[model samples]
Target: MAVSALVHLVTGGLVVGGALLIVLGWETIVQPVLGLFLIFLAAELRPRFGKVDEERLLRRAGVPRLFALLDDIAEAVGTRGFDAVRLTQDFAISAVPFGLRRRRLDIGLALWETLTPQQRIACPARARGHFAAGDVRHNLMVRTALPP
Candidate 1:
């Protein structure tokens, strides 16, 4: 993670620095165009971090029992409960950190149907465990640095 961060920082710095140099160089026929291109490239390489949108991909899990279960699991794991619980048609479970201190959880309806009650609980609990263990933040940092 540290190495990836360092690489990202160095690469991003070089890109921006090159753009600055091009813009600061004495006027020339091609300098403005080249400087603009370099500036755009720098912007593309920069990391962007933002909260995940919850309204578009899935609907919030409104079932009272499910919310209670999630709360219990969150308490057991010693982390704040998820900000939103979403249901989807896919076959996976995932959790993501949002703005500031919020986190969101998504459970696919297909996956939910396949799991036994115990397994259902275990799924999100495992996801929450990743957050509690700080894996989520670490992964986010690495991803932000690397982009695609």
Candidate 2:
């Protein structure tokens, strides 16, 4: 996925460069208009990067026990601790990268409400597995480069 993102970036760069050369080499109105269109295309393909708002998410300070469980899971999986834990309405758990090395874990309230304690542990364990496999970085790259 990182490779894909790099490819997209390079392609965007080439498009913009070629467009600029075309506009500069030719004085025609059509050439400048085409260059502007290519520039727009490059902007659209550029990755969208952002950080998760930890303030809005349920923090460990507010729910120590839950974070402790997550800590245990992280230890068991041999992965680093999560940056934050968030509650959501969806019936799924997700580990999302915020920036370079920051990862936030999102737990669905509906899923937590339905599952037993053991089952709840499994959710994050599986999410941690992605990190354990060392694919989180690539996953983040793909996610950032692609449009939803």
Candidate 3:
């Protein structure tokens, strides 16, 4: 009889202990852990979920300098005969080969937001052609990427 009572008491204690652990864990660990996980998930997804405007980008990067730089590039390449250059924060720049043998230099303004500083500075360095024709071609490519 005593052994049975001890067994029962031990079983009862274990049951109570398990219940307390569940309650304490839920309050102090599980709920807050899940909440923090959700916050981190939102932060990681924010960029893909967020919307960015071109004017806002230009304002952040200094509009006048960007315009003058584009202008200087146009004149340096002697492609001023092309249409008037317009500043925009729409499109990214990359170097591409246009000729049959892939030896010709062509800079592409990708169909996305404007050049990041690295691409903007590096693209012209990758270009080669008769300065005037190359400038005209480069501007045409950029214009084509723009909306109608």
Q: Which candidate is the best by lDDT?
A: 2
Q: How many backbone clashes can be found in candidate 2?
A: 0
Deviation in Å, model 2, residue 87 alpha carbon: 1.0
**What TM value does model 1 have?**
0.75
**What is the C-alpha lDDT profile of model 2 across 7-59, one tens digit per residue?**
67776786877588676957677777777777777776766665566567767
Better structure of 2 and 3 per TM-score: 2
> Which residue pairs in model 3 clash with each other?
91-112, 91-113
Residue lDDT tens for model 3, 1-148: 3443454454455555555555555757765555555445434422121122323233313556654565566566554311122233335333332222122222344532356777665455434333444544334333222223
Candidate 2 segments whose C-alpha is farther than 4 A from its true place: 2-6, 50-55, 136-138
Compare candidates 1 and 2 on lDDT and give the better one. 2
Per-residue lDDT over 56-140 for candidate 1, one digit per residue giving the tens place of the 0 to 100 score: 5332355667678888999999886777776778899988665545577878889889999899889999989988897835366
**Model 1 residue 139 CA deviation in Å:** 4.9
Ranking by TM-score: 2, 1, 3
Better-scoring candidate (TM-score), 1 or 3: 1
Better of 2 and 3 by lDDT: 2
Model 2 CA RMSD to the hidden true structure, in angstroms: 2.8
